[model samples]
Target chain A: MRYGAEILVYLKEGVLDTQGKAVAASLTRLGYDDPSVRVGKYIRVEIEASDIDSAKETFDKMCKDLLVNAIVEDYTVKVEELR
Target chain B: MRYGAEILVYLKEGVLDTQGKAVAASLTRLGYDDPSVRVGKYIRVEIEASDIDSAKETFDKMCKDLLVNAIVEDYTVKVEELR
Candidate 1:
């Protein structure tokens, strides 16, 4: 079976986000209220697996091995069977 | 009131995603199956607004004005009141 996984990787709390800060400043300068912003990566991947469990397992390994930076980032993943 | 908005920006259909292609190729080389991948941006913003509708409106303007590349990318945003 094939599955689709959506992975969101974000910086850990308390970590400085220079990009986000810059964006927020821009918005404020553009007349929006003082807004707080955080930026992250959203990755969608299609995987071939026998079942949902194995698909999720593969996603976990992918995150740990390559997708996420464990030292400063955290990730959440959701997987659904692709019809 | 305070509101939180989550925005996802992705390339339109048929747009070439070089970064995604590179990551997918690396994953395959690292023994994962030939998975198809798409990469996007996830932005979380906190805004001060009177209501959810206004918050969404602000988000729309944000996307149009600065957050998204309208020619090659599309975006979806969801807003919820912050407690």
Candidate 2:
């Protein structure tokens, strides 16, 4: 069997996204006046695991310990088993 | 008119995805054993710009000057005209 996880991490609300802001400003410069652009990063990961449970535990740990910084960023994790 | 950009950036080939590696190791501990997984991130942006060309230029400049560090990461940018 195989397990897979997809993680999305992003800045918490209230944090200024300078890049997103600049892009928005440029849009006004270009002429489009109503488009809304927020910049964010998404990570898609595939992994080999023993089974679903361990895959889940490990992934949760992975997110907390490594993938993202909890204070400034918030993340969601999903795990599925492929047999 | 509105402008949008989507960017996909990932670590260049040969750089060990440390977290990715750890996730792989944990999978073996769980029991399902044949899935291969790799991790990567995606970003979607919507910006207000003067027009298509300027939107495109600012975006290109955006990527080189700020969005990504060219050495360790590789990225592709796409722009679309929205109404």
Candidate 3:
């Protein structure tokens, strides 16, 4: 079967996001006071897996091994059966 | 009141994603056969808005004005009430 996975990869808390900071500052300058925006990557993938469980396992492995830099980032994975 | 918005910013179809292609190639090399991956930005924000209707409008404006490059990118905004 085929499955779809959405992986959200984000910087860990306390890691300064320079890009996010710049965005926040830009918004504030435009009078959108105190906007807190953290930018990250959203990866969408379609994979062939035996079942939901195996899909989840594959997603976890993918994130850990290649998708995310665990030392500086954290990721959340959501899997669904694809038609 | 405060509202939370999750903004998914992605390259529009037909736009080539060099980074995504590199990742896909890396996965194939690792034996994760024919993995299809598309990468984009995920932005999370907490904003002060009067109501849901207004909140959605604000999110839309943010995306149009600063968050997304409309020519090559498309974005979806999801808003929720925040405690």
Candidate 4:
């Protein structure tokens, strides 16, 4: 079976996201009011695995190893069967 | 009313994502296999607006003004009423 995973990776609280800050400044300059703004990475991947559990395990490891930087980023994963 | 929008911003097809490539290389080095991978931005915003249409309009403007780089990126917006 194939599974799809949506992994959302965001800067950890207290982490300085310069890109986010720049965007926030731009928003304020443009006169759009917002409480705050933060930006992060979103990745979608399809996995060919025997079961949902294995697909999740593969994605979790991918996040740890290559996707999310644990020290500066936090990530959430949503997995669903594609077939 | 308050509405929530999930905005997904990704590089357009044929655009080079250097970050994604680096990660893909690292994954290959680590022995995890996937068909391919790409990385992009995800933003969630709470909008105080009259209705879903207004919320979508606001978010679309935000994306055009500050969020997605339309020249090199494509974005999708999903708005839902929040309470």
Candidate 5:
């Protein structure tokens, strides 16, 4: 199966998103009006695997072991099979 | 043309992502291991428009006015034409 997975990761509320705020400021400087902003990450990965189970196992492990950091971010994965 | 656009918004480096961290914890509790997490947002928009310029205008406006809050995030858009 062709494993195409999209994962979205985001910071918890109240976490200071200095980067996001800075971007907002830049936007205003560039004449764009931005009232609020939330920053998050999105990743799309295509994997070569056997089935849903293996895909899940690999992705789940990847996310836990490398993709997501338990200390600063959370992630969710949506898997799609293309074959 | 069928306008398919994908935009990714991310916090500048040094920005804190609290929500992402929380999710990492949840994953760990749920039996996943996470090391470091960075949170950002990804948006995919499909618009029925005339051409690239129009699609650009619509998306640029949407990101500035609605999709991205200039105050907290930086966004870049990629457009694909589907006929």
Candidate 6:
């Protein structure tokens, strides 16, 4: 079976997001009203797996091993069977 | 009123994603099987607006003006009223 996983990787709360801060400042300067911004990564992966559970397991492993920075980041994964 | 917008910015089809290709190669080298990967940006913005419709309009303007590269990238915005 084939599965598609959408992973959202974000900075942990209380972590300073310089990029987000810069974006917010830019928006405010450009005259957008009172905007707060946070930026993150959205990763889509297609994987071969036997079942949904295993596919999810693979995604978890991938996040822990390579996709996410555990010290300052957290990630959420959503999986669906691909046609 | 406040609205929160979730914007996903991704490379258009046929655009080359070098970072994604690098990540995929590294994952394969680390022994994940038969994985295809694409990477994008997830931006969460909180804005003060009169209503959801205007909030959405703000987001579209943001994307067009700054957040997205219209030539090689595409973006989708999801907006919700913030309590």
Which runs of model 3 end up more than 4 angstroms from their true locations?
A: none
- All candidates: DockQ: 0.92, 0.29, 0.80, 0.53, 0.14, 0.90
Model 4 docking grade: medium
Model 6's CAPRI class is: high
- Candidate 4 Cα outliers beyond 4 Å, as residue runs: A13-17, B81-83
> Which candidate has the highest DockQ of all?
1
lDDT digits (tens) for residues B1-83 of candidate 4: 88888789999999998877777777778997753677888876665887889778888999998788999999999888987
Highest-lDDT candidate: 1
DockQ-sorted candidate list, best first? 1, 6, 3, 4, 2, 5
Instruction: Name the TM-score of chain A in model 4.
Output: 0.94
Interface RMSD of 6: 0.7
Docking class of 3: high
Per-residue alpha-carbon lDDT of model 4 for A1-83, expressed as tens digits?
A: 88888899998989987877777778778877763567888987776898999989999998987788899999999999985
Per residue, candidate 5 scores C-alpha lDDT tens digits across B1-83 of 76766678766656676766765565566654342444567655665777999878877886876567677678889888867
iRMSD (Å), candidate 1: 0.6
Model 2, A1-83: lDDT tens digits are 56777676777878777766776676556654544556665565555666788878767776776567888788878787765
B14, model 5: CA deviation in Å? 30
Report lDDT per candidate: 0.94, 0.68, 0.90, 0.83, 0.67, 0.93
Residue-level lDDT tens digits of model 3 in A1-83:
99999999999999999888998888888778598899999999889998999989988888887999999999899899988
The 10-residue segment with the lowest total lDDT in model 6 chain B: B47-56
RMSD for all candidates, in order, please. Answer: 0.7, 6.4, 1.4, 2.5, 9.5, 0.8
